[model samples]
Target: MAAVKGCQFSASLSGSCYVMRPRLHRFSVKVPFFDGPLRSRLVSLCCHNPNPDSFIVDQTVPLSKNPTHLPDDCPQASASSPSSAIDFLTLCHRLKTTKRKGWINHGIKGPESIADHMYRMALMALIAGDLPGVNRERCIKIAIVHDIAEAIVGDITPSDGVPKAEKSRLEQAALNEMCEILGGGIRAEELKELWEEYENNSSLEANLVKDFDKVEMILQALEYETEHGKVLDEFYLSTAGKIQTEIGKSWAAEIHARRSSRLKNKLN
Candidate 1:
């Protein structure tokens, strides 16, 4: 059994209440019984166990407080409110409208949007073969969020001359603001964590998602090369030998094979 320390027990006409504070979150436990104060005392005695791990704590507690009000320049919405959803979705509209800078710079017509790239990555994650100890669902979620900050920061490519650290800082700030607009609930916290995981390459899921990112780019480059009859060796060279996961390497190899075949046929 888990021991709970510093639990405050109180009696009420309807039931008994106990408040438990864990390492990072708080839990409110209530028990209703027809008995009187004696039952409440007995329950409190049981709560005094010395093993902390015996008691299961709910992790659904909100990590941060939602803003009670919006700023003067923003729409009026509270965290977890309907208006907040609308406002956040409105902001996300930029993702669908902003074209990827790489394609634009290459003189490709009708380039894919950032959201379009993320959606395909998510689909890649969905259809990925099962790997031992890897969380496919987490990979899918990471894929969706990996480029979400681009909605505000735009696509900062290598040619943009922005320092890597500066690009990360800008994206982090944008992600934080987006989460704040989302009303700072569990979902918002999740988005922040997923984005951080991908940014840091901290987990297997993050590793896979990163590979998917490169694979997606190279695949797009191949498609554009075929459509526009332009050689995009830089894209392929940039991603060469950088895929960390076996699945990513396999997918990239297949795309490379197809591109090679296409180039050979072009010579004929």
Candidate 2:
């Protein structure tokens, strides 16, 4: 649409674009999206208010004089604003209903949701004790958010044939979108940092969370095997040598021992 005179258009982080018109000569609308003579004209109208709180949006001025067409809720840019935080929370609700595709595709009946998987991983983090240099709180946070991106991108397993780089890119984009809902504040940055750390598998907490992830998978596999009388040895094969923490390794050993004893007893 063509630009309107005495009005400026800008893109909002909420994925919508809108136009604002000055309500009074005392305040100026900063339209970062415009260019050329129009940009200079709008710049001249922008008020240099020392107090940020004084800046107000004139929502009545629509992008193309069509007020009804703009985004329903005009969200504030402040990180601490309730609108942004609420938007983020609303996005997280999807994870609770989205099932983990890996288990479903493997023919595991009544597979768990993504939230269910993360819940068990978080519990694993909570009960984990006495790691010499590890921070258990960090582990819990990492475990909770590790699969958060899957809420947006869904669970992409190795069997999906997506390249590792491509999968990472997709998940990262989804994570960024999710964080954007939180207004890209300190909390958002921390979430990104922990998620990246888990992705890299380089830190102690990350390593512990990674092992916890595999441990959760194998434990679930064992449960399915016993409950359904189906052999899920492939899950064991996948995690055989990948667990990183001593605690994880020990848990894996116990899980394996129990499975072996059960099979041996059946044979006898």
The number of residue pairs in model 1 that clash at the backbone is: 6
Query: Which tens-of-lDDT digit does each residue in 73-114 have in candidate 2?
Result: 322222446888888888888899888887888787788899
Kindly provide the TM-score of model 1 when superposed on the true structure, using C-alpha atoms: 0.74
Name the runs in model 1 displaced over 4 angstroms.
1-79
**For each candidate, C-alpha RMSD in Å?**
9.9, 12.4
For residues 1-268, what per-residue lDDT tens digits would candidate 1 score against the true structure? 2223564444332332222333434443333333543322112223433345434432221212432221222121214678888989999999999999999998999999999999999999999999999999999999999999998999999999999999999999999999999887556877898999999999999999999999999999999998899999999999988999999999999999999999999999
Question: lDDT (0-100) at residue 178 of candidate 1?
Answer: 96
Task: Tell me the lDDT of model 2 at 111.
Answer: 86
- Maximum-TM-score candidate: 1
What alpha-carbon RMSD in Å does predicted model 1 have with respect to the real structure?
9.9
Candidate 1 lDDT at 212 equals 98
TM-score of each: 0.74, 0.69
